[model samples]
Target: MSSPTHSANTGRIILHIGTGSFHRAHQAWYLHRLRESGNEHALDWSIAAGNIRSDMNPTHEALAAQNGMYTLETVTPDGVRAYEHIRSIQHVLPWSPDHAPLIECGASRTCRIISFTVTESGYYLDSRDRLDVSHPDIAADLDGARTTIYGVLAAILDARRRADGGPVTLQCCDNLRHNGEKFRAGFAEFLERRNLAELKRWVDEHTTTPSAMVDRITPRPTPDIRPHVLAATGFDDRCPVMGESFAQWVIEDDFIAGRPAWESAGAELVDSVLPYEEAKIRILNATHSCIAWAGTLAGFEYIHEGTGDAEIARFAGDYITQDVIPSLLPSPVDLPRYRDVVLERFGNPDIRDTNERVAADGFTKLSGFIVPTLRDCFARGASPSATALLPALFLAFLARWADGTLRIPYRDSLLDHQEIRAMLASEDPVAVFCADRRVWGELASDSRLVEAVRTASHSVNLWLAARHGVHNRK
Candidate 1:
């Protein structure tokens, strides 16, 4: 580990577990901006990033070839594109079978904080907020050595506890609402599963998990991004990332040891991250999903194209104005302005965010993003008319999957192919689909959701067919 006096390597360290493009464009970008602003303390906060999945080996090769430096390409709605070099990550170990390097980094005295971005499903959490030990990875990680979040975290914290590394914070940059609290519970429950009583005590006394809301529409980095960066910057950057011009991060100001003054780089350091998170989740995220699914049904390729379409645009607008905004009435957010900004960001043509990319994990998005609005509608005794359009759109999208009419592939980790087949074969497929608790929660049995979805699904099918018929005539 580098000491505080080490000029080249800096002082305080942040161990990030995933080297995904979103992290490159979002969290690490913030720290890089802090350093660029000539903040002396920012020099101490170099990131050491690695990966747990083999899928990230290509990303590892690309980034390591560049010494963790990458170009960020930003585009706005008016077709303006900009590029910048980002360099907050100073060291990376990549993915390896040996855990020595990661554990060593996590246990070091200078490593004040650790963060990760494995997306929502990567947490391996069930609806009840328990670790699904039955999962193959969790099962393998239980009594053996493996690299799931819990396994790696346990190994690292065990070393930290033994070394008396003082206090540290765990930051989950994933999009789960109440992410910090949820991940804290997950780690504790995972510790209980492992029976690491002593280490659990150490974590309870020393570690803090702070929630954050991060927004940046980072598309999956493909080979094209590399050449785009090269052409724009006169550098052959291998792992360049691209996003919309808009970015926002709001974090809870609860750190155990200490943290970088991230606000120096435009991040919001607030007493609570709830208002920001709720606004982003219900408005931005839910609307993002609505556009992805509805736009796919309308045969659009990219999210911007979908958000640009008149019908799809109205679908997203109605969702926010009619149902979601009402559910979140009298909140701290300036709803109207934020809504327009979200639309502008989404419709940025220069950013080619694929509907297939945004539309992945529909099952998870239904529960995590859209279902809360539905629940709120029922709670307030309001008709979920607009909210019901979301699920109706999703089910109609799934029909494209079942009928082999999908123009692009879609995948959801939690989706069951057999069950989908069964639903397609049922007398009332909409009713069968509505009954799945994973998608609808306890209200899966509610009759209003069933009828609303059924009517909406029929209307969606007709709309899609009409669009296709007109196209065929043309």
Candidate 2:
């Protein structure tokens, strides 16, 4: 283990919550690269990362033990592997149930940016982008619990206000649509619910939350990664991370306090991240879920396995070609080339991205990733048959999950287990699922969506029946 030492640079910090593989591989890697760029402003900033929950305590311990340094392993689609020792995270705060250390760090005047990656469903928003105040976690947070992001952030901001800490930016690095704006709205509403009118006003005047689009395919470390790291890098890195060689970050350039020169590290500082975010959500993210659910149903263990399957690849490719690309016409990005590149990246066998990991938050993915394209297509008087296959595959996957036959755990942070079970037990599960206001919103009553899902579900069933030997087998 590297000997722990204080950072020579001081006065500016980005306190990133959720020290998961993606955060380490994407944001932290960018900072590491920026520092290596020898830019004068690079050394003036560093990361202080921690998690809100105890589940990542092991990661925290390992990272702290290594003095916030770890090896990042990345592989290209052509099987080229590379390793870099990442030292961007200068401090790894110990986890506590109450988030005391996190709040303290976030409340510090020197901490100019507070960023997080809690995944799509962790935002606890409905299809209309409204915070679900009725959610158990949100409700608990409103009652002074610190289990959720809103709760923890509220505490942090409140302490910061009391300390008269100068302005800080709240940067959201999740895959959710308009992540920073949505987080601001949710946080505002959460404060309203908690009766913190003064704090809300203070936040309105003192902070700027910028939407960002972050992309990286960082998979959970498998059993063999540690041994490979030991042999290759001479470090027994307990908190090592692995990801695809491709990565991207597009952020709205609206920081209140001074910020890092991240553009030096290949990050795009944009006036608006909308076009890029929309393209990524509809094309790459939606198709990723489609392949994962389809692959899971086909008994494939990794994403590359499903992408390698001709039929599965056809379904995903057709979704992008037939619906998503047309819906996102005249985009700044070359949608067709982006789709091809995304597929090519997903087909990288060495990445070992798992179906279970990709397929976890299907409920959130349906609304956030797939529904926009369907809505746009319908608005333009076009059929979204190919796009419809994504939800159909998810519905089929949910059926396996409801029937206790799913090979892997189906974890949906936004899923209401009892409600889903009731829906699945209903007379027509597809119709019931299609009619869910939370998932379909105002489109729930639209017959076009219902009929499309019904038809696609049938096709999915037929496909699964033909692949019976591999269906849900380990």
Candidate 3:
């Protein structure tokens, strides 16, 4: 075990929160490559990883056992694969019931940047992009307890402000739309709810939360991967992460306390990450959901399995090429080329990205990814045919849920048992689903959007029925 060491020699630390597969594969791998970049200062930037939730304890313990050294299996579409040892994570802080250690690290002087890869739902934001202070965890944190990221961050920021721990950058590497800005906003609201005026001022002045766009297809680790890594690397790496060979990180380059030379190691440190963020969310994230929901309804297990099916592939490509691309047209990014690359990534047979994983957080995915392009298209007076299919597919997916057909867990941070009951009882399930502020935002009230979703849901129902060799009476 590397233990906890602090020094310029050990590398200036980035205390990364949420030690998930994506972090190990993307952010840590980038830092690992930076360490290999032969730059003197790059050696000083390392990750001390932890998680906000206790369910991640297994992965955390595995990393702690391996001294945060694990094999990263990179597979390409053409079936090329390589296994490399990722050693950038120098310290793995095991999960604690109370995050005292986490707060301490945030209060420490050695670490100047705190990066996170908690999924989109981890943000706990309402439809208005404000912190859902009513969320039990957020409320608990507001009541001087800790649980959610906001709670943990509040504690860390409080400690930092009190100790003069200096400024730290909160780099959000999730698939969030305008992640940095949204995080800053929600965090500010969280602080306000906690009534920490002095600390809030300190935060506004000292810290910088930079938006970032990160891309990689690191699926959930499987048991077979553990044995495969042992065979490939001759080491028992319990937390070995496997992903596609493709990876990219685009940061807004707005750090308060300096950052690593990530650009030197295949990251793009840009002045603004909006264009990249828009392209990624619309073309990649949205279409990913499109394929997943469609795939799930069609009874495909993995993403590649569905993408390999010509019908599902055409569905995804049509949505992107018809609706997403046109909405992103006349832009800085070559939309067509970006779409092609994303499709290629999704088609990686070795990745085995499960459709259920992609389709789980449909409520958040719609607003963050699918809805933006939809709103853009509608504002520009464009038809919502291609984009409408996503909500339709989600509705059908929900219908499967109502009928007890969905085998995998569909997690929504805000969804309650009562809401599920309401969904099942609702006569107009599609309208009711679309009307939820969480999924459609203000678009819920848009008559055109609601009607489009209804029509699209019917169309998707027919398509799904045909795929299953069933003829609908209607």
Q: Over the stretch 115-141, how does candidate 2's per-residue lDDT look in tens digits?
A: 999987789997678999888999999
- Give the C-alpha lDDT of model 3: 0.83
Q: lDDT ranking from best to worst?
A: 2, 1, 3
TM-score sort, best first:
1, 2, 3
Cα lDDT, all candidates: 0.85, 0.90, 0.83
lDDT of 3 by residue, 198-311 (tens): 989999999999888899888887788878888877888777888889998989989899999998999999899888888988888888888888888877888888788888
Better of 1 and 3 by TM-score: 1
Per-residue lDDT for 1-474 in model 1, tens only?
Answer: 222223433488898989898999999999999988998778878888888777888877778878888899987889788998998888776577866768888898988898999988788888677888888888878886666888999999989988988889999998788999999998898888888889899999999999999889887766777788888899998778888789999999999989998999999999989888888888998898899998888878889899988988998998899888888778777988899999999988877778888888888888878888888888888888888888889888888888898888878777778777788789988889889898888879689889888888877878888889988999
RMSD of each: 2.6, 3.5, 3.5
Error of 2 at 449 (Å): 3.2
Please report the TM-score between candidate 3 and the true structure. Answer: 0.87
Candidate that scores best on lDDT: 2
